[model samples]
Target: MNSAEVLSSDLDLVRRSLLVQKSEILNKHMEFKNLQHSSAKATDEADAVVQDLQDNLNIQLHERDQFSLLLIDKALSKFADGTYGLCECCADVIDVRRLKARPLATLCIACMEDQEAPGKHLFQ
Candidate 1:
């Protein structure tokens, strides 16, 4: 109905979405761990090379999932602190649209752009 109500609803949705993502990542991580532990023995050099490649790919995927989990956890913590959807850099309320699009986003668009800008020194 009102802006506050809408924002609350949006935040609730974001929280649910983040939880779902966290669960999915955790499930996938567990499955990958099981697969790694049960990997088939290499029969020959070619098989060994393929197994190595597959192992390397799995590690990379696991690392990526771990990073995603971290971001999701941070976002969920923000909700607990009553600061979800607020820009970390400006302390301003991030646009609800942006939050919907990227539930793990910490910085608002302007701040993100500035951070990504080339030749922009942070220490200067």
Candidate 2:
């Protein structure tokens, strides 16, 4: 049942993502404050630095948003499929602790280890 409706419990994952978003917003506010102070003296190099920081922050926030969305979507799908907290690969049951820590994870630790470990044959 590969459905896309997340379980109610997955809202905890969304909450965690929201916390990350809040931190990012705080960082952006700090950066804006610094930019405001720097623009007072407004040298070309300083202007460039502020612009670069803004660009970097934008990219970072975009990536974070994308990651959050991916996690949420995974949770939603699992809810629909009645496979929430189960490993997508190998069909093994995922530990509750693992899910709490990493709701976005699709693979069980065993599967993850298999992927990360280079087999001897592959090294040859």
lDDT of 2 at 60: 79
lDDT of 1: 0.90
| Candidate 2: tens digits of C-alpha lDDT, residues 1-124 | 2322453345456446645755675676577667657656646997778877876886677677667666666666676677876777788877656766776677889888878787844874
Pairs that collide in candidate 2 are 6-76
Candidate that scores best on lDDT: 1
lDDT of each: 0.90, 0.67
Off-target runs (Cα >4 Å) in candidate 2 are 1-49, 119-124
Model 2, C-alpha of 34: deviation from truth (Å):
17
Candidate 1 regions off by >4 Å? 120-124
